[model samples]
Target: MGTPKQFLFLELFMQLLRIAFGKNMVCYWDMKSSIGYRYSKFTSNHLIQGSANCSHLVYASAHFDAITFEIHFPQHDPPLPIFKPKTLKQSHPKLKVYLSLGGDDDANDKYDQLKYLHLMEGSEHAQQKFIIRTIKFLKLHQFDGLDLAFPLPRNQPSQQSNIGAFLNDVNRMWGSPTTT
Candidate 1:
């Protein structure tokens, strides 16, 4: 699930996939641009507005199964509250939606702000707070699950350990099945 800020290419890709596979595929929008470090204030409205005119094209397309809008988190700040989609899935009740955490880049600074000295070994308190807040936000917006995208820095022992701790914390908080 790559980031599709404009959703134009994603729309076309879905169309092609439908033609080629003859199956309904899911389209998860891994929104890298919304991460706090690069896009702290970004919101779903940005994506919606950017691709406003393409809503009809996306909704009318027959290739997509579910369209999960991933919002990468790069801050210790509580996850952004979900904003209901105005177009896609308005008529479909079974479409799966999700709110993703982390991204391709490591959120070391953000983790530091949260007072988690080790990225991977966040305290139980920190993990619980993150998971609880995230779940609240997801439920508010009607999301179905979460996607943890914490990427470890390669060849860095300390960073890798931190990332491992982070994953462990996440697994403990959200459980294995909740991860995407």
Candidate 2:
């Protein structure tokens, strides 16, 4: 049985569905768990399809306004989807699927993700390139949008400003009718 909060959330979600005014309930799925095929059967049927079994129970895809696949970075080699996002989209047309950038990594070299995010948006040229490539990657992979998952570390003013500027650029690009 779920907690009272979970039940209340479900009730709210159901009400939203009835009224056709859904709240933004974002579900973040880590690439490692998704790619490893360790998802539950309910998840498989509703959100993603996989052969492996698990005990964890995930809410239906319709409950979420969007699902974000975590930890892809802006680089020359774009990410390839191990879990087929196209299938999920086809199954739940109203559910938005986003590709997230920057996340914690176990490997020491890739651990400081904020640093990579900074380097990606260090200059005007680099920022533009990152946005263009990200857009292209999203289009290619059928992603609804890009999620900048970079955390603003405490006392890091420069990093925060860079992230803010980069976000503004991203918003400008996506908000424009001409750009995709």
Listed in order, each prediction's TM-score against the native is 0.48, 0.58
Task: Quote model 1's TM-score.
Answer: 0.48
| TM-score of structure candidate 2 | 0.58
lDDT of 2 by residue, 1-180 (tens): 335676467556655654563454456565433234322212333234221111121211111011121224322233322454567756455666776655444213433534554544477876666666667666776777766655435685665656667778888987666656
In candidate 1, what residue range of length 10 has the lowest lDDT sum?
Answer: 58-67
In angstroms, how far off is 82's CA in candidate 2?
A: 1.9
> Candidate 2 — which pairs collide?
none
Best by lDDT: 2
Q: Kindly report which residue stretches of model 2 are placed more than 4 angstroms away from their true locations once superposed.
A: 1-24, 34-46, 49-81, 106-114, 151-154, 177-180
Model 2: lDDT of residue 139:
76
